[model samples]
Target: MKFAHEFKETLERECFPDHWLAAAIPYSQLKKCLKKVQRELESLGLDKETLQQLLAEQTVSPNGEPIPLVRYNLDHASSRSLRPCLSIFVHLRHGQVIDAALSPASRAFLQRLSGAHSRPSAIDSSACTTPLATPSPDVSSDDNDEDTEGELERIEVPLVFDGEFFNILQTDVDSLDALQQQEEKSMEAEIKSLGAEVSAVVGPPKRLAKSDLNRWREIFDLYVNAQVFFSSHELDHGSRSSVKAVQQLVWFQKQVQTRGLLQSFKVPSSAVAYSRFLQLNATLLQNLKFQEINKTAITKILKKFDKRTSLGASVTFRSAIRSRNFLAGSVAKKLCAQLSQEVVSTVPRAEDYDCPICFSIAWYPVRLRCSHLFCVRCVIKMQRENKKHCPLCRDEGVMNADLNNIDKSLEKFMKQYFRKETEEKQRANEIERGMEIFGDQYKHSSCVLM
Candidate 1:
């Protein structure tokens, strides 16, 4: 299918906001402008075939590296439209043909244009319109000594349509960048507000009729495991394509629904906050989709531009354009970092602070000299076994660890966030210690042994 039609259909089907639709790249118009560029090149007797040959011609430098005769530059001319300057090195050395790659017609065209010292003619001005550019002289190299002295002189090929096309493209990209920044700020604020709301419901341990701490913790755990929109797995990078993000999102939503998280919300506002959370992700996904398609459109147009004009603009265009966010940065990356910091981090995940030895919450977390943490019981057992090295880093801090190793701050954090889990772990540790001292015949007792 024609990309222009496909681009139009995707925009319509996506049902993006009208303002976003307005800011999208003018793919159809750019295609039309490309046609004009092709025509403009042809009018100067530089057909695609002629240009391909001329552009392919190169001079072998004294160092044996090939220097391109035609240096096509698309750079910011003082923050204006990316001015594409097609600077061709004209061999004025006795009007001799520069490269064997040039066809008979191309050789003659270049040679004639370079030798011209008279006032610019219609054909010469069309091809090389700079005010200093002279007309193509009819005099051969044999007939004129004046054309024989100088080496290659670089001259600019004046083509307006392609420049206009770049201007239109760059302008739209700038607008899209601005729009994305505005949207990002709005979403960032929502993330902050939502974080505070979720924290209020789940942070404290005292159970109320409206307590939904466990439910929220489970929800967040499931959300992290699902890795929706971004992967945090060791093997996989956090970056996910919008399509994969959609799949992960769908899976996450399904898990929440199947587990009946919404109906179980004791705090009424938690459900509302959850809904807003989903909506925020949905909005982000839609924004990602919009950015994805627009970026694809940009790629297609640049490829088409190169295919038609042979300017190889796909690579050059991206570098030339003055865009920092829209094209270069990912919406998911920036927003996901904010979501992790503000929202997900509010209700601390227990697994993050689990002991490596027991794979459980590290109650009375023992911070080894290596900074690796374990439950106090695990450290005592390791010491009893005469294992002196840190299991993770092989640091010999295990035996050296004393009361100072007890991370008081970390213990307080675990107690605050994992109160029930810590209580259970404390009971288990006591039972284990009693059995170890009493040769497994000791009866577990909660009361103090008088």
Candidate 2:
């Protein structure tokens, strides 16, 4: 059936992607094919106006953006009674379309329409002139014929990524794991060599304090768990591959609700930190492989925190000792980067990284004095409007100082980890700018006459 004008308008209003709409079978073409059974359809009490209304009612569902329609032929239609029989077409991503069947209705009106079977063969001559197929009461027609008969029986539409893509991802993950193993061996060799040199020069190496080793072990624990989490979370769903980042996120989120891996693991920090750590590292793991852990950064943090229990060390230490929290932002970055390897994964949930106001990941991130974060461009706009307080916390006197010192850590993190999302956010921002500058002509970029 043809899509109603209202239906098309609704899809357009929702900004359904143009490439997707272009790939589907046209509504007009489907309507043309349905006309072959027009006489039969009318006999079943479905005139043109009534059919149009029915088509319009089922055309636009709110389940997904622009909704999905099913249109397929019935393989067993000749043996059944005809009432409100419909064909279905399931739309999958990247232009794959599959045909399905519509379920039979049990309404009183449909029962009346198909009641002619109860009478003898002496009904109207017109009914004999144009015979229609009957629909089966016992069989559910919603399932497709081919789907029921195949190995992938009763599979839903929007099929997962093919085997080739999964193989590629698996190879990449294996390579990353191998690389991490090599790095560990190299580090071990370097540590042995350094120990030999120190023993020759300083008589003999001193025994390490229990506290210092325990702290490093805590940091290492956090690193290992984060690695295991990012590595296996995608593999939790057996065999099937997702074609889109959003789909991966949606499936993973559902799995997280049912079977969480981190809830029971005792970490050096709060349980909430485990989720945040997984999210942060998982975002990085999608695009990068495990490399050498930043040992220099870790060492610097550890040295500053380690207490001077050794006799001679107490004289050199005058200031207060700063203990490192392995879960802290700075330390976690160094540790997670070293342990986690990048593999096939989704673009991170935008809410985890985006500034709440501008909703973009670009244009200089600024951490407010009170710890609220925003993009610098948005901050300037706030200043111009005399919004002197932090929008989130409502803390006053933000305008007292020039808001400089861009949050370089966050900015660098976004640039390094979220390359794909950065491009998307920038493109959306550019489109917004174009609309403001070019007015109505922005959409008609190729119109030479204008």
Candidate 3:
């Protein structure tokens, strides 16, 4: 999908603040904004869903009628192939006031567009002759040949920006280029200096004289790569100092894997140890954006490997060699955090909003003293069963805690984020209530014994 031309114009004219433009305007942010709008419209006792259905029914144009565009790309949580390619399309009516409070960027963008531009297209009709984007032809058409079409459908999004935003971006790009050039020159000088130092070492063995220089170069380059990954130069010396141990382990592993030196180094491949290593790597990657990694934990793995390596290799030949910061500056850490935690789909993760015991979207959710959340009904059931501990935490006296004390914030989060799930739960509850009041009609046979 491509954003409408008017939408682009709206964003440019809005001149949203910088922070609002974070994460490059992901589709989730746009949907969240529209959902809030839907909620607000619902608050006025006008069902937007029903109104839209009526609008579609009454409208004369069958094919070209405006329809709500809400689609998401669902990918596995751990998939690396996912990219921010989803597009949004919104149609604004005249005098429709949009509040820019959903996100800093979204709010400012919409508010600016609403205030500056009143028309559908800000550009002159003669300059832009392309008609408004119609619904995709494949949607309603009966053509089977479209399935065999060789080319994938493409969306062209035009770059739109006013003078001030363009100038700011240009300046940042210029500064980054200059800094990169300076760093390259500095690194080149440092490498030459190190080479000179290696030559100056007196009484060095022949291995150190010839073979070791190449080894040293490889090791040095690995360190350079690690520094680049961590952006060590941008960090203060103290922060850089803390990562030294981790940096060394990363450097050593890189050398062994790249040079086929694992055999020479006698690195172990015990199943248990390798399993621990993989586990640690997965955890580190997942929480890498928010937490300082477990340096001591990594050190333990290396030490174990070092001890095993000294014991020498087994008689059995193994040919394969496999290779694989917690927070400072929390605000920046948080901004980077989004790159790691992606929403897999429009539907929220069930585990996040559901009660562990009931396996349903929690109603009247309450956080225990131990911070585990469960619905009020579940808590009551626990109390009635003479349970004195929290089902999740097993904390004593949890049943004595007030059931009326609800986590208002978490409730709001569930409502906003899990709208579809909540609606499904609500419908189920209604059916259950009807069955309880009227008795289950299908519980017994309907045949009479005349």
State every prediction's TM-score relative to the real structure: 0.84, 0.23, 0.24
Choose the strongest candidate by TM-score. Answer: 1
What does candidate 3's lDDT look like per residue over 249-292, in tens digits?
46656665777542332223222222333333333333332122
Local accuracy by lDDT, each model: 0.79, 0.37, 0.38
Give candidate 3 regions above 4 Å deviation.
Answer: 1-339, 342-348, 401-403, 430-450
**Pairs with steric clashes in candidate 3:** 20-105, 100-107, 291-325, 291-326, 292-325, 292-326
What is the Cα-based lDDT of residue 399 in candidate 2? 69
Superposition TM-score, candidate 1 onto the true structure: 0.84
Clashing pairs in 2: 70-88, 70-89, 71-88, 71-89, 72-88, 80-134, 80-135, 81-134, 81-135, 82-134
Alpha-carbon shift of residue 239 in model 3 (angstroms): 29
True-structure RMSD for candidate 3: 31.6
Error at 5, model 3, angstroms = 53
Cα lDDT of model 3 overall?
Answer: 0.38
Clashes of 3: 6
Which regions of candidate 1 are displaced past 4 Å? 61-65, 93-150, 207-209, 233-238, 368-372, 385-397, 438-450
Poorly placed runs, candidate 2 (over 4 Å): 1-350, 359-363, 397-403, 437-440, 443-450
Candidate 2 lDDT over residue span 1-450, tens digit each: 223443455445544345323422233332333343443444444344443433343332212223223221111212221112132222221122222222233122343333332221221212222222222234344442332321110111111121122222223334434443443454444334433332222211133511122222233333433333334456562211212333444455455444543343333332343344345434433322212122222232223222211111122221111213211222224333333322111222334667879776744677888877776667766887888998889887456426464788777666655556666765665666678778856762333774
